[model samples]
Target: DAAKEAIYARLKKSEAGAGAMHFPLDRDAQYFEQLTAERIRTRYVKGFPQRFWWKPDGRRNEALDCRVYAYAALHGLLSMGLNLNKRVEALPPVPASRQSRNDPRPVTAPMTASPRRRRMAISSNYI
Candidate 1:
């Protein structure tokens, strides 16, 4: 897809040098943790001015009298590159039979029962 390719190109541009770019491990449990630390270190080393925006409109902008600049991070670009070859699939819907209990029947008046006889002598019923 054009969109996917565009994103890939931007990411490649953002990281620039081959040695500066990171290769993420797909399906790894510690991938995010490691990637986050690496991104933070890269940004910290590059500082505010040296960093490049990962998106097309992400660069600093200035108007009549106001100026705006966005913070840059390349972990997203690395993530996109790592997942570019994979197809995302939506999770299957939950079955109706597995739904929570929410009984709709109306409640009826409680049934009354006769009280048991107190201190009754042993009778033929007990025998």
Candidate 2:
């Protein structure tokens, strides 16, 4: 319950555009629906009220599950001393001369290594 609450709070913050996370701009209505498919519910069990997450029948909650799993993965990485903010800050800045006049966003150079090599390097860090 605690973990779920924390994840939900982060999600709320992201939805409100007040967090470090943001959903992709291309997500459709169905995606949003699935992302919020579950709700917290309380039921009496053995004369005690137990609060838990619940979703109605026929509702697909894969999006919500994926979000929770992503949050857990981020926490796991942080526990391993992987500082995401520091990593981002360490990225080489894009030169003003390389920026396109039409595009406002600064473009960074692409990785020189192959995708497989990059994957292997990342996996080896935690191995």
**Which candidate comes out best when scored by TM-score?**
2
Every model's TM-score: 0.14, 0.69
Off by over 4 Å in 1: 1-26, 40-48, 52-127
Tens-digit lDDT track for model 2 on 1-127? 5656776777676345545456556799998889888899999999999999999999998988888888788889799888767767777876777567565554554545799999998999998
Which parts of model 2 have CA positions greater than 4 angstroms off? Answer: 14-21, 95-127
Tell me how candidate 2 scores on lDDT: 0.78
- What is candidate 1's lDDT per residue for 31-106, written digit by digit as tens? 3332222121114444654433333233221220111111112345455563422322233444566454454333
Among residues 3 or more apart in sequence or in different chains, the pairs in candidate 2 whose N, CA or C atoms overlap within 3 Å are none
Model 1: ten consecutive residues of lowest lDDT: 63-72
* Poorest lDDT segment (10 consecutive residues) of candidate 2: 14-23
TM-score of 2: 0.69
Q: Which lDDT value does model 2 have at 123?
A: 98
- Best by the lDDT measure: 2
